[model samples]
Target chain A: MVDGIVITGAGIVSAIGVGKDETLRSLLARRSGLPGGKVGLSDLQMKTILGIPGEETVARSSLLGILAVKEALQEAGISYTGTAVLVSGTTVGGMDITEEHYLEMLGGEHPELFRFHTCGSSTDRIAAYFGGFGSLTTTSTACSSAANSIIFGANLIRSGRFDVVVAGGSECLTRYHTAGFDSLMILDKEPCRPFDASRAGLNLGEGAGFIVLESSAHASSRGARVLGRLDGWGNACDAFHQTASSPDGEGAFLAMTKALEMAGLRPEDIDYINAHGTGTVNNDESESKAMTRLFGGCVPPVSSTKSFTGHTTSASGGIEAVICLLAMEYGFIPANLGWKEPSEGCIKPESEGRSKVFLQHVLCNSFAFGGNDSSLLISNARDYE
Target chain B: MNRKVYIRAAAQISVQEPLCEDWMLDPKQLSGPFLHCIDPDYRQFFSPMQARRMGLMFKRAMVTSRKVLEASGVECPDAIITGTALGCIENTERFLDPLCRGGEETLSPTAFMQSTHNTVGSMVAIALGCHGYNCTYSQDGVSFESTLLDAVLQLECEGAGNVLAGAHDEITDNVARLMEATEPGGYPFSEGSVAMLLSAGESLPDALCEVSDVRILSRREAVEEAVAGYSAEYVMRNDVTFSLFGRCGSASGLAVYAAAEMIAAGRYSSVLVVNESGSNAGLVFLKKV
Candidate 1:
């Protein structure tokens, strides 16, 4: 098997916190960031909302992404030199800005505001901040975007292409997204409860999460402190529906199964699962079924962190991946906040709550609209011997 | 061990015309500053209800994917992978327009649901009932090349037999205006779709070509290193006669175009094609053997 890609450093900016340490602290404290909505979009306006704090200065999405990337770079202890590939995933890039400014443009004034309409401009601006010029790309696959970005970055490293890559995803709350979810009738009126029988819908949140990925050789050359190694990843499509997952969670199951198979591990080897858990009725049910089918009665401790941070769309996977890596490092399982009781469909594990077990392997899932499903397996590099 | 994948059937729908036997050989010149696909009659493939909800890009993707499936004689590919630079821009524009106009009220879900970049791939899957490995990559010009790389990987690493891989981009009125306004030096606004049926173990009577290698890069040195790493014949190959480059999007398509030109000109029996997007490049080496 190929030597796994090393995640030397990571950064995060979420409603709960601005950096990795703060995010971890919030998780341990069970501090949910799903309070009064911001960006002029109130909970009354948006059926379900998870607004980011301190939204006055930076563009919510760009701010979160920039801060996260900066922290990641600092954690990696590598100065930005030479060409750096920037692969970002986001479902709503600058939509928050465009949605607001577009009105000004249509009002017969301030036509200059129209420039933000191009989703790529967000990446360009972010790249400009870092003085990066080698290559920059963006992926917009709804919810699974960041996971795909991570997968793409891993492939590039495995293929011996780039020396380093900043791969992650960022998204900010927007009136457009709020309206879209409201229209779909999937926006919860209160904090989202994943896999809860009375779960109404998902509460939309915004944040950015980034990981500095480098080849094993590059990481060792720099003496970087490797948090975890991205051992295996798999992406599969259900081809079932546009907005809803298959009833049997075929895509989710395949994605998880493929990820485990790629790592040459059985389902029992997984210690914890970071579920996509948008808190939507369909998603929770489908993901539960998929877990049941894959792990059977001996399912590992699975939790949906969306209750704490809300569903961040494309950024969900990236942010949650960071949480998983952190949990592995700390040897703790983050609680599934707002999970009062498991839904009827849920397959509970033997462990009642977060275990103090030494974490070896972790699985993260991100399933998006259009039946896009992705799973990533991360493990401590030293475990492979 | 990595296994070589072959592109058995290729289809394209662009500003020129739909994928016809003659269209690939003959050329069509577009007159307008902005380019739009000479859209095939989508009604022929989809019903009014389904067709009504689909934007121009979705229609083009469905039409092209169908044409490719027919050409390959494979009803459902084992995997479907797609790439789009700016996916479903029309729907996105539509959804954004009213929200921006009416203060987030009266926004339509149809356009919003269809606005995501993977809509085309999802629609293809829904149409074919192919619940296989489906993915959509959106990294600007390299989108298609990335999709091709993943399809090849599915064959090499995932043991996928038949895969449908392609790239598409569509031009919307707002997007076209934005392109002209922001990056005028860039290629004119264009819309098109291209799909290829890929497989391992050649079975066709005269297989077009077998993909030998693929790569993605961010820097010029990296690109050069990748090219050199392959120790591939940079200039003349014994069998490469021509190469085809999709040069509209950055020089990303140049590598592939050059290889195809060499093969097509009878200078070589095989060819290689490369496509790149904003910061990523993809190389597909096709050998006659």
Candidate 2:
């Protein structure tokens, strides 16, 4: 088998918490970040709490990315490696800043604000803060953006392209995105209930999540501690609908099956699954069908951390990857908060968090609009020779 | 054990004349502040209903992708990857303009639905009915190059036979005015869609060129060095310096197309193409065998 792409560092910020510990604590305590009122955008006023604090005038996306990168580099105890590539993912990018100054920008009052309108600006700012990266790029495939970034980073390493890659995604809440979602009628009136019979839709949230991936050879050479292993990743497009998933979950099933095939693992080998349960009527149903089809009658225990942090969109993949790391480290499976009854084909999510089980391999799924579906396999590094 | 990737076919729809076989030989330079793409007949490509719902960028992407696939004789590709700096900006602005003016009450859900970056790629997939590996990238200047890198890896490392990788960016009136004001002397505000069918097979009927390698730079200092290294390695003896440096940053795929054109015309055996936006940069090495 091919050597695993070892994860050496991780960082995250979300509505649930700012760092790994706080996020994990919130997950274990079954706390929801939904604060009963309108957050950023108007008209969808059901008390969805926007997690970012009002600390700086800079774009919230850049701030989140910088914060996450800082923690990841600090944890890894490395800085400014020459051959490093930073493949960041973001959906809204600097839309937060642009939306705040849209009127001014439109009136030609502030041309400076115009530069921050592009998605690459946030990624560039993040790279600048870290001195610089030799290679940097951004992926924006809706919700699966960050997961695809991780896959890109891993491929860079596995293809003998680059040894060190900082991969993840960041997104900040914006009135533009919120209103768009509102226009689509996908925001929940009550706090989101993933896999629940009464589930309405996802509660939009903002945050950033990232992990530092290094080759095992490079990590050991630098004496850096290995956090986990990125065993496999796969991405597929549904080609079914622009916004809705196919009834059969063809894209989702292909993504999972490809990831497993790449990892050289069987369906029974997966210990747990972090499902891409967006708490939407379409997503929950489609993903549930996909999970059932992939694992057959013996589906692994599953949960959606979105129940705690809300759907972070592009950053959800990165944040959930960090959550998976915390789960493995703490020897626990996170609870799928707000889930009461089982939806169609989905096995009942673990609403009660479980701990002290010997966990090994875990699968993380992220499906996005436009049929962009991706799945990642993360395994405990200690299990590898 | 390095696998070679070849560009089986390349197609582009840009500000220049649409689908002219000899466009580059006598290219039309953009003299105005804005350069809108010369669109092909939409009626021939999309249904009336599809055209009614489609935005400018989405239509351009579909036409470009269809032309490229037809040119390559590829009915279905293994993967479809795309990148766009400002995806469906016209639709986004349409939705945002009304929402910002009349609040959420006047919001158009159709415009909002097509605003995401992945919409163009998905629309193409819907037309092709390709349920294969699909992704979209939207990082300013390097967006297209990022998608190209992913497609290259898919073909070289994974067992992908053919991958359709493309880029599309449209400049709305507001965005074009903003860019014109910000960088008065830079390349004209422009819009375009470029697609290349990349294959790992040993040969093709009319391979434009072999993609030797591609590198993207985020650091200002590293850009020169990386470009120099690749140029020295691949295009040392080549004479032509095909460049669009200060041109439209968002339409970085133009440089890739230019390089492929130079190689395909037998003007140069190898060409190094460079594109930049702010501090980010993308470099491609193309060689004809």
Every model's DockQ, to 2 decimals?
0.40, 0.69
Predicted candidate 2 versus true structure: per-residue lDDT over A1-385, tens digit per residue: 1255899999998888777887888888877787331123321221122233344345667778877877888888878755698888887887876777777788988766777877788888788777788788888888999999998888888888888999999888888888888889999968888889889888888888999998888898889999999988888888899899998899999999999999899999999899999888889888888888988988899999888888888898999999999988888999888888877765688888698875689999999989899999999866623
Provide the interface RMSD of candidate 2 in angstroms, 1 decimal place: 1.6
lDDT of 2 by residue, B1-289 (tens): 4458998777777877665446776766555677778888989877899898777777777777877788888998999989988777888888878766766798888888788888988888988999888888887877888889989988866678889999888877788877766666645678888888998866654788898888787766766777767643234211122122124544567667767777887888887766655577677888885
CAPRI class assigned to model 2: medium
Q: After TM-score superposition, what is the CA distance of residue A233 in candidate 1 from its true location, in Å?
A: 2.1
Mark the 10 consecutive residues where model 2 chain A has the least summed lDDT: A41-50
For candidate 1, write residues A1-385 as lDDT tens digits. 2365899889887777768888888878877888422223332322222232443323456656776787888898967734667778876776776677665555545454444544455565566567664666676778998898888777766766577888888888888888888989999989887877778899988888889888888888878899898988888887799999999999899999989988899999998899998888899889989999999988888878777788888888889999988888777888776776657886542223464657789999999999889999988655633
lDDT per residue for candidate 1 within B139-191, as digits (tens), equals 66666666777777677656788898877777766666555554444345566
lDDT of each: 0.72, 0.80
What is each candidate's fraction of native interface contacts (fnat)?
Answer: 0.50, 0.76
Name the best candidate (by lDDT): 2
Candidate 1, B-chain TM:
0.83
Top candidate on DockQ is: 2
The stretch of ten residues in a row with the least summed lDDT in candidate 2 chain B is: B237-246
